[model samples]
Target: MWAAAKEYFTHPQMESFKRDVINHMRGLWRTWRSKMNCEHVKNHDNLEDILNDVPEFLIKEDWEWLVKEKFLCKEFKKMSKTNEENRALKTMNQHSGRRPVRQIALDLEEKLGRPPTVAELVFKTYKEGDMIKDDAANERHAKILEIMESNPDFTALEVVEAILGEQKRGHVICFGGGLRPKDLKSSTSTKDATDANLEAQLRRSDEEKEALHQSVIELKGTVSEQAEEMATMKAEMKKLQEMFASSQNRQH
Candidate 1:
């Protein structure tokens, strides 16, 4: 895959791009499956017929599994009900339509002198015609205003948490990039701990390497000193033998 690419990318960049692609594909798959459920699975009693009418893109076995195992499951039904309730809470249409809130926020940041607050961005996007869509939104807007006025330094995330409290797992209150605060916090803490562990391991490895290097140097010095001492002892023994031989010759 790296060879196939015309341009070079760092490993981290490649990994990030891969994640983005996988996320996009998953999103597409979910959207397609949801539409299929709405069209074929919901309000349809004939499973065999639905299986027969399976789209060309899906295998018959996969379609059967979806119809029999997934759509018919109790958990799926309960989740569907919960999703419907959540959908009902969306009282206003977003002016930005299908565009992500982050993009809208970026544009707002350019337009305003500084970055716009979440409340300001929400009010700008969540509108119908010329006015606020409903009383619920109006009340939320008022509360956000009150909070911001009281605490001028609070960030968008902070404001959201203040207004809506902690979000449930797998749920975001306001299109806040699909991350629950509690989950994000836990993930961040875990990542930090893992990184710290890796750093400690690397430090220990380096220390061990340095200690081994020092030991090798000391061993070499000891061997050299022992060799020099042995050479001096051999010279002294040779001198003693010569002196003994010379004395024996004189006595003869």
Candidate 2:
């Protein structure tokens, strides 16, 4: 890879070409590592290993000529479809199509105060349809998912807010609860007094309900005890009356 880079850099018009090639190669390396389920590459240390693995045919004079004359200058360049190049290209394509999960997590954490789990993050970030069909959008969605997963508990609105802070694009309209930009702005504009009062009322209502329930239970118990005491008094009075009537009859 160094040799190829040096050779391209030596040519005056090839500086840009060299840079593009390096970028392409680095992208390929990333793809390869992802396929192998390896962690992120920290540096360019294994660049030589990657280059060495590529066949000598790719570096041939004719191939180099084609790269210099055609691919480097094109805005949307097509990679070679040969086996090795295809493998590398496949990884590259996949990498380009998806966003890094860690970045998504960071974004979520910055906005929502917490990250979401993987499933929650995926749902929050991605669209409802097929990912392959919506590559570019899916890539963005994946990035958002990654952010949420890393910072689980971040609200969707928080994620949207963070995104808005970075880019003024009118995209990312709703975060959660179908909140619109105008709604957020309007709500924020309102006085804090209303919110505080509402919260206090809710608390008071809950406390009142609890107190009322306790009072009813106590009253019921008191009523039941009083009824029992009255019944006992009535029985005692009847017994005394019966005794008095019996004594009067005996005297008669």
Candidate 3:
């Protein structure tokens, strides 16, 4: 399919568009199938009718195997039930709906002017409107923040572990299973670099503040010396006036 479609991408900068599309094709297909299963397949009574309504991209045999051998099997049913229960445990509402969580992360990075920490990204995506849906999500967000603050060098995976009490092998929870450990690592690296730059800027500001404080102290000292000199000059003038007045009285 890509071989035939690649010709339409003629722009020079879009040379890699084919590669990008191919890389994302699996995720897109999974999302599409999940939507179809939830909205139509599970609710419909006639499995034969669904088989007949198979997407054009899928061959008839393949569609039949997926519907009968895969989705309808006992193991798959058990897995689906487990997934539903797990989903029920989640307290935070998904703000993205059908949209991908990865896209939300990209939008956040663009809006924030830097790569957001994992905690920040989780909070933004999990929040419903202006607030989190329940105490569970709020507590998770708070814990993640505390861990990150206490250990600035902790990776995203570590932060998740500290919040959830364990880090599982595949996807990180609250991230919608879109972010993997490697992805989190990459984000952490970028965040660390940004944080380092900010720290450097802070150190420079502190140096400037200290220099200004010292200059203020020196200026106060100079002003005090000038005040003392002025007082001495005033005393000398008064003594001269007294001496002149005494001389004038004696002459009279």
Candidate 4:
């Protein structure tokens, strides 16, 4: 309550923070799984070896909750599908001749390198962020969350990929390119390119601003120097003219 009062986590900021938590937990799960065949380690002995590497982002109690909540996911083969994912894929499939939009979405997931939209929805509940309220997609996201609870190692991207498989070429062009640029917003590679361009542009702008500021400072100094020189010359010329007039009067 106090943290919310302090505005420590704005809505978007909280979402960003929670995304990190998902990334961290997913990483820990992958590390744990990697030891399945290591001769020096016992995979089934306990989760202790893996849990020990928990990052500072989570406390001891948080770790346990995450284990129960995000880790120990259900069997991949038996897991249920996400409604949000299903709906998204179905929408795509409807556009194409394909019977299952999920397959095409998974194919895109692999090729496009993005998580299923449904999986993104599930992260909200797992992180308990500011956007944890229920909506049309909540039920579907909940199913995915339950699966994650049991099979923590399976990432949202992987879950979608498993059903979609590696062959992207054969799938129907379901979810055809967005009618405009806004549709391309979800593409990670595209977003990365755009972000890079924006960053470079911002850097150049800053540099230009600094250069202009320095030039103004230099011009001010130059103007002051010129004014002093002009005043001195004027005074000397006036004295010379007066002296010449005095000499002429003496000659007369």
Q: All models: lDDT?
A: 0.63, 0.46, 0.67, 0.45
Instruction: Please give the TM-score that candidate 1 achieves against the real structure.
Output: 0.58
Q: Over the stretch 1-252, how does candidate 4's per-residue lDDT look in tens digits?
A: 334323532332344244334544665665554332242222335667545645455676766655444444454212323533555564112222332343444444556565344344233323335454445445545555566566555533333333334324322222222112332333344224233333443554565566567767778998999999999999999999999999999999
Candidate 3, residue 62: the lDDT equals 87
The true-structure Cα RMSD of candidate 4 reads: 21.2
Best prediction by TM-score: 1
Tens digits of per-residue lDDT for model 3 on 89-137? 8654444666555556556767997756767767787678887676777
lDDT of 2 by residue, 212-233 (tens): 6776787899899999999999
TM-score ranking, high to low: 1, 3, 4, 2
Which structure among the candidates has the greatest lDDT? 3
Query: In candidate 2, where is summed lDDT lowest over 10 consecutive residues?
Result: 188-197
The stretch of ten residues in a row with the least summed lDDT in candidate 3 is 8-17
Report each candidate's C-alpha RMSD, comma-separated, in the order given: 20.0, 30.1, 25.9, 21.2
Candidate 1 segments whose C-alpha is farther than 4 A from its true place: 1-12, 89-96, 168-172, 178-252
| Candidate 2 error regions (>4 Å) | 1-193
TM-score for each prediction?
A: 0.58, 0.25, 0.53, 0.26
Order of all candidates by lDDT, from best down to worst?
3, 1, 2, 4
